[model samples]
Target: MAQQKPTKVMKLYNRVTRLPYGNKIFSLMVSRMAPYFGTIRPLITELRPHYCECLIKKRNAVHNHIKTVHVIAICNGLEMAMGVMAEASIPSHLRWIPKGMSLDYTAKAGSDIRCVAEVKPEQWVEGDLLVPVTAYDDNDVVVVEGHIKLWISAKPPR
Candidate 1:
């Protein structure tokens, strides 16, 4: 079989992440691509095949009554990481969409949070797949853990 080319999302990531202020540019691009994601004010810290990382600061807009990061905000961050991973890793022949997510709030997020998601190399395939994601506070405590399911399939013949 022939090697597949990188997806357009990955190509854009690679292109911008090479220049100065690339991270900022990538973040803006992601927000534009998914307007809902922009609401959480996420910063795309890393993006690569099978892995993605994002940071969301603790701010009033994202805080709950208890003055900690809201659960929904954390969820948004998790999805963003998983979405980027899926976009960068899925083979060119296949397309994917998030089916659902299973999540657990392990701890209170008292500070800025960093979310990371990944799919093992062996797990890449053409079908339903779950990508694991975890979020940590500045102190490195795992605040959330879960998986996002993505339905993957070959594009219909044009």
Candidate 2:
């Protein structure tokens, strides 16, 4: 058997951040690699195969008509967290893509938001899976709840 290599996300996190700059490096890397993530400017607070967490500041760019974090911005944070989680957790031989998403805006987000995504190893199979993602406000109240459907498959021969 061939030696397994680290996932792209793991390599990027280790190489770019070097565990020194902390969330700053992660925010820069994610924004650079994925322009959409830049729009929301999320700072990753935690990243691992089983879990991923990110923070989105309450900036004018992401503000809503009511002077609160926009609903779409909250969704963006959720997706970013889920994307990182999937990249880090999925099996090396398998590939995954966001198939769809469902979200519920549960409360008003008046301050910085924290988004988290998590998945169990058993959930990784060649099929459709729904990953749970949640976003909370500074008060620790859930502001958003959602599930991102990911399509998993085997990578074709090079």
Candidate 3:
């Protein structure tokens, strides 16, 4: 009998990321923490096979003394949106990761932030996946916009 592969446990940036090593887990790990991963903590709101959304609130931890949302925090949210979207846009038999992220801060985010990343894999064949991200403030005002370019590997390039 073939032995069952034990479920993998992933630490969410440090805690809570556990159970099975899927693309989502990897992306979350990569996006959430590191000396270079920035310091803002992003919360994953939706995880779908074709897209995902994440959210984070503007607090002193992610704000400047002026109470304005920090630019880096916005970047973190962008990365999460991109990562989740990319994960959804790819086939399970395939592999890929983010190559670049371009962002623009349009307005001030003075409250909770929400980032949505959507994908259409069927619309893509052989090329980069451009996941457009739009972040909104509590009042539904557009606070940031960005695009994350992901290079889909031809194979499982672990």
Candidate 4:
């Protein structure tokens, strides 16, 4: 057969630079945490000027021995959300990378997972942006809340 068409996600990425970056960020995560997020495929569901949302369905592979979401998988969701939000908020002229992150997992993720990152870009100054990420379970319970700190690098890092 002829080559298959790229996915809808891939089609959308072609028209959006930030989304493509976020996609790359997700793909790169396997190296960031191989055994934990071994085949992480985050899909950007929504992206706008001030907000972003990504999603990853929960599978047995992501569950811990107790059948709860693995801690590292929660970390993966947190990072994906932050990346999407950062892509939406930061300008292409400026480069930024996540320097630090803080997370609190309050609830256990039990089913398909949703990661939402929302922020008021106007509230940030020139040097740093705090991307807030919230992950919820299938029942809409907040499983985790976190923030990713990104360092701006339009110029050389000081």
Estimate, for each residue in 15-54, the C-alpha lDDT of model 4 and write its tens digit: 5536547555644443354444435455556655556666
Which tens-of-lDDT digit does each residue in 1-158 have in candidate 2?
Answer: 33346688877776766677767887787888889999998899888776899999999999988999999999999999999888877888789999999999999999999999999878888999899999999989999998999999999989
**After aligning candidate 3 to the native by TM-score, how far in Å is the CA of 28 from where it should be?**
8.3
The true-structure Cα RMSD of candidate 4 reads 8.7
lDDT for position 130 in model 4: 76
Segments of candidate 1 deviating more than 4 angstroms:
1-4
Instruction: Return the clash pairs for model 3, or none.
Output: 10-17, 10-18, 12-17
Q: Give the TM-score of candidate 1.
A: 0.93
- Models ranked on TM-score: 1, 2, 3, 4
TM-score of 4: 0.70
| Candidates in order: C-alpha RMSD to true structure | 1.5, 2.4, 6.7, 8.7
Per-residue C-alpha lDDT of model 3 across residues 76-127, encoded as one tens digit per residue: 7777666655544455445666788888899988888888887664734456
TM-score of each: 0.93, 0.91, 0.70, 0.70
